[model samples]
Target: METQLRKGAHAVFNIQFHIIFVTKYRKSVINEAILSKLREVFSRVCEKRKCELVEFNGEDDHVHLLVDAHPDNNISQLISFLKSASSRIIRKEFEIYLKQFYWKKEDPSFWTDAYCIVSTGGAPLEVVKEYIKAQQKPKM
Candidate 1:
């Protein structure tokens, strides 16, 4: 993992976050098309927020984001933005899929309210990279 530290007005920092968000009820609705769109959506969101999206990957029900943001950026706010923006776009674009799995009177929730966010600065980037990569495998 090549992590270049970012410099701001007064502070030079390298802050990265490992963020995970699951579909509502942990439904396995995500496919390759959705994953591709998600990567694009997340990249756009991060760019708008002036953050770097280091890496992104997902399974059927959830997605993982590795973001390198400035220290001044509010992590929770970023998470909210990611979830909201992606949810709206995804639900609209993939209405057919949503209808089958997320049928409801109102707009079905695209993502669960709860999320997992962790700071990656506590460990080496390589270690974190391996950990994230391992998420794809089944436990023995």
Candidate 2:
């Protein structure tokens, strides 16, 4: 994949993260339908935050995402938004299916409190450097 960079008035950055989110209590609540919805929700969240959802996939209880974002973006905040929005929507839309996993709780949380986030790179240093060099430098 080509490296995607974001430019600001004084900076340019290509920040990518591999994010993993597990369901509350690691219950196998996710199905093909949930996975599809999760992908859609994640893509929309990333777009709203000016990030790119490069890749998304998941298993029964957890999901993985590759996101490309700008330096100005706060990673944690982005994650919070994603989780909150997705959880709300999923719980609401799939209430019947999710009832089994959440019947005991008054308020059900779809995801666990902790998440995994790792930095990733799409291109090597030399290639990135060459691409940067090829860009028209800002007029001083």
Candidate 3:
């Protein structure tokens, strides 16, 4: 993926993250329809946060996202928003499909509390270290 730097008033940054969100109880309820809804919701959430949803895909039980975010964005809060909004919308839109997994009596949670997020993009750590080491030092 190409790394594009974004300019803010005081900072220029290129930050990207690979995040994964799993379904509560690892239920295999997600299908093409739900995935489509998820992509729509996630894209909107990212846009609202001044970020971009670079890539999005998922299996029956989990979803993967490659997000390009601004430096000032709080990733934790963004994830929370994504989960909450998507859960509420999905529960309402596909209540029939999800009923088997989440009974009427249950609270009807979509995603698990735990998630995996890793910083991505830019050069490898060792490559960056080598480049820094190769820089010429100025004479004092």
Candidate 4:
């Protein structure tokens, strides 16, 4: 699966990113307010970076973002831009829950520094989007 996923990614300059990252320590703070604000911040950041925000939705502990980032932009820079910009806004603007978890007591930050990135442009956009849109936590 990894090989099939990674194939053509090296040779082809075209690539899109479907990324998933979690809150620091997987804390559940991505409530309605934070999610809404994050939507706005991510939109602005993507516009600034010339990336496309396909979709972004989160539960409490984690987030999933489908990004159409150009090949010139790698996963790290994109995630960095999103995390930094969103975290700052979220930390200051909506601190009800974020305060105790990340903003106060030097908790390091809200989001964990780890992320998973995959190229979706290798497949048809529709197929890629379906996979992402269908993504959900494993059934109990």
Highest TM-score: give the candidate number: 3
Clash pairs of candidate 3? Answer: none
Give per-residue CA lDDT, model 2, range 4-30, as digits (tens).
577877888878899999999999999
Off by over 4 Å in 1: 1-3, 122-140
Give candidate 2's whole-model lDDT.
0.90
Kindly give the stretch of ten consecutive residues in candidate 3 with the minimal lDDT sum: 102-111
Q: Taking the tens digit of each residue's C-alpha lDDT, what string does model 3 give over 11-107?
A: 9998999999999899999999999999999999899998999999999999999999988888899889889999999999999888889885567
Minimum summed lDDT over a 10-residue window in model 2 is located at: 1-10
Q: Which is superior by lDDT, 3 or 4?
A: 3
What residue runs in model 3 are displaced by over 4 Å at the alpha carbon?
104-106, 136-139
TM-score of each: 0.82, 0.82, 0.91, 0.71
- Encode model 1's per-residue lDDT on 1-140: one tens digit a residue: 56567788998888888999999989999999999999999999999998989999999999999999877678889999999999999999999878888887485579999999988876677988999987866769
As a TM-score, model 1 comes out at: 0.82
Q: Rank the candidates by TM-score, best first.
A: 3, 1, 2, 4
| Alpha carbon lDDT at 129, candidate 1 | 93
Q: Which residue pairs clash within candidate 2?
A: none
Model 4 vs. true fold: TM: 0.71
After TM-score superposition, the amount by which residue 102's alpha carbon in candidate 4 deviates from its true location, in angstroms, is 3.7
Error of 3 at 120 (Å): 0.7
1-140 in candidate 4: lDDT tens per residue? 23222223454444557878788888887888778888888889987876778898889888788876655566677789998888778777877756576655665466788888876655677887899988897989
lDDT for position 52 in model 1: 87
